[model samples]
Target: MKTILITGASSGLGKAIGEYLFHKGYNVFGTSRHPEKVLNSPFPLLALDLNQPETIGRCVGKVIEIAGRIDVLVNNAGVGIMGPLEEIPGDEIRKHFETNLFGPVEVMKAVIPHMRRQGAGHIVNITSIAGYTGLPFRAAYSASKGALELLSEAIRMEVRPFGIKVCNLAPGEFATDIASRRYYTELSPASAYAEVYGRTLELINQQVSGGDDPVMVAYEIEKIINTPDPKIHYKVGPFLSKFSIVLKRILPDKTYEKMLMKHYRL
Candidate 1:
């Protein structure tokens, strides 16, 4: 059985993916900040805090110690930050990048050498459709994912020679715990964006509540693992969300911006 290591597996997409793969007979090692909080998980859970980069090496070491080899590494841990770029504090922005981008990069660095030694492995980075096009009020989150998307592309080429495959899995809004987990900037009455920010936040919550089931993403991940050669970029979600990536490629910049503005009522 192929051994799989997944980060942020306490809940949401990460949890779903881990469970799916576990039932499929893969040796799955999952990570959460407090693994004990997860009730009755079939697989072993390790403690991992993406914000604390120093803990990443230890977390990866634990997985290797238990699994012997990691055939797949899923960089699925991430946090969401929502706010106007201008008003979002520097600390908040740094925190957002620390969890979403730097954390995954650190995990990648820790796992690559082992995969290289094994002669083959797959690394899946969970990004977002927002990475392809910026989202209003989610500037930091969008930017972080976008950075990961590009980084995955570059690393894909660099690691292919080592029999290591890197894929950027970009999903649109999904029915996950993201709504509750996301951090929002304080909106004061004097703030210019207060009214619109409120409306946008509500809209975002509604969309996420009604979005695709995260199990769909897990299914895609399963397929990617089974395929002999997987695409570097896999956009998973509903039709419009997946199409948005294609639309961005074909539409002029101004047109795309107008469409987004209208959709968000910004």
Candidate 2:
């Protein structure tokens, strides 16, 4: 059985993926900031905080100790922050990167050595559809995930010679608790962005509530793992969401920008 380690598996897409893989016969271990607090998980949970590199290393070590080898490492743990970049606190922006980008990099650093020794492994980074474009009120998330997307492309080439495969699976909005967990910058009634930002926030929430089942992502991950050679990038979501990438590629820059503005009614 291939041993899989998934981060942020306490709930949402992470939990769904972990449970799916566990029942499919893979030896799966998951990570959370507080594993002891997570009750009745199908797969065992380890303690890990993306903000802390120490926890990342320790969690990876414990997974190796238990599973002997991690055939797949899924960097799925991340936090969301929504606000006008101008008003978002600098500290919050730094904290966001710590979880979304740097922390995942640390996890990858911990696992790559062992995978190198074993001569085979897969690393899947879960990014967001918002990463593909500059979404209104999601500047931080867009920048971070976009960086990860590029980082995946770069590392995929670097790691190929080591028999390590790296790919990014960018998911569009999905039915998850991410909305509740996201950090929302204070919306001041008199602030310049209050009117548009508040409206966009509601729209974002509605999109998440109306999103596709996250199990679709799990099945897509399974397909990627089974493929002898996987692509550097894969996107899963509503047709329009995935097509937005193509639209951006083919449409004039301003045209696309206008479309987004119109969609969000900015």
Candidate 3:
């Protein structure tokens, strides 16, 4: 059985993917911030905190020790930050990048040597549609994902000769517990963008609550893993959401900005 290691498998899309693959007969190893809390997890769980980059190598080593060899890695662990760029503190922004970008990159760095030695492997970085366009108040989150997408593109070429594949799985909104997990910047009562931020926050919550099932993303991931050669970018979401990428490519700059503003009622 092919061995797969997935990050953030305690819940959300990560959990769904782990469970899906386990049922399909793959030897699945999953990571969670609190592995013990995931009582009913079908696969082996490793404790991992993306904020602590130093622990990444140890966790990957543990997987290699048990699974013998990791055939695939799914960097699905991530956190969200929401607020106006100005109001969000520098430390919080750093934290966002640390978890979303640095953590995954470090994991890749740790696993790449093993993959290279084996002469074959696949790495899937779970990015977001927010990467394509900056959201009204989610500037940091957008920037982090955007950077990850670019990193994936560059790394894909670098590792192709080694028989290792890398791709960005950018998903649109999904009905996950993201809202609860997100860190909202503490807004001051006198802040200039307070009212608009409040409105935007409400809108974001509503959208997330009504988003598509995360299982859809899991199914798409399965397809990518099964394909002998997958594209560098695999977008998964509703029709309009996926089409937004094409729109961004064709639409004029100001027009795209206007559409985003109108969508958020800015």
Candidate 4:
């Protein structure tokens, strides 16, 4: 069976993908910051925390030890922050980058040499539609995803020659616990940007309730895994993504800003 390693497999979208793909006959190796939360998974588990390079390296090393070859690497582990840009603390911003952007980079870098030796592999990053278009009060979150998207683009081209393909799956809001744990909340009482922060949280609070099932995003991951040539960017879920991409393309800056303000209910 083809083996796949998925990060963020403890819950939500990553969990769904891991379960679905494992049942579909892939030897799924999964990672969880809290492995006990996913004790029920049929596939083997690894303890992975994006904050620690050692944890990432160890997990990848273990996957290789067991799976022998990693046909797929799903960089799905991520956290969310919901608050105004100015209100969020520097450490919090650093945390956002640590998980969403740098974690994937570190993990992918660790796995690439092994993939190069194997002569074939797929690296799929679970980004967000926010990567393409900015959302209200999610400045750092959006910036992190934007960086992932561009990296996926450049890296995919570079890896193709070695029988490797890198893909970015930009999910439009899916039902995931990431929305519940707004990482951008204040550190203490005397924090800055409270009003804007509240607005950002409110915007995210509203977005999560109106999304498609996490399974849909999982299925998209499955499709890409089976695809002979997946695009550098694959966006799934919501009519809103289409509208957002179009507006971003055709609308003037001020007009697009007006549309986003109204659409996001900000």
Among these predictions, the greatest TM-score belongs to 2
Deviation from native of the Cα of residue 220 in model 2, angstroms: 0.5
Candidate 1 segments whose C-alpha is farther than 4 A from its true place: none
Clashing residue pairs found in predicted model 1: none
Candidate 2 residue lDDT tens string, 142-188:
99999999999998999899999999999998999999999999967
TM-score, every prediction: 0.98, 0.99, 0.98, 0.93
lDDT (tens digit, per residue) of candidate 4 on 1-266: 78899998888888899999999999999999878776588877799999999999999999888878888999999988767676678898998899999999999998888899999999999888888877777788889999999988899888889999899988887767776665755545566655545665666666677778989987888889889888888888898765688778888988998988876555
How high is the lDDT of residue 72 in model 2?
A: 95
Residue pairs with backbone atoms closer than 3 Å in model 2 (clashes): none
lDDT: which is higher, 3 or 4? 3
| Cα lDDT tens digits for candidate 3, 92-135 | 99989999999999999989999999999999999999899888
- lDDT (Cα, tens digit) per residue for candidate 1, span 1-266: 99999999989999999999999999999999998788888889998898787778898898888878899999999988998889999998998898999999999999999999999999999999999888899988889999999999999999999999999899997998889999989979999999999999999999999999999999999999887889989988989998988889999999999999999999
Report the lDDT of model 2 for residue 209: 96
Find the candidate with the highest lDDT and give its number: 2
Error of 3 at 10 (Å): 0.4
lDDT of all predictions, in order shown? 0.91, 0.94, 0.91, 0.85
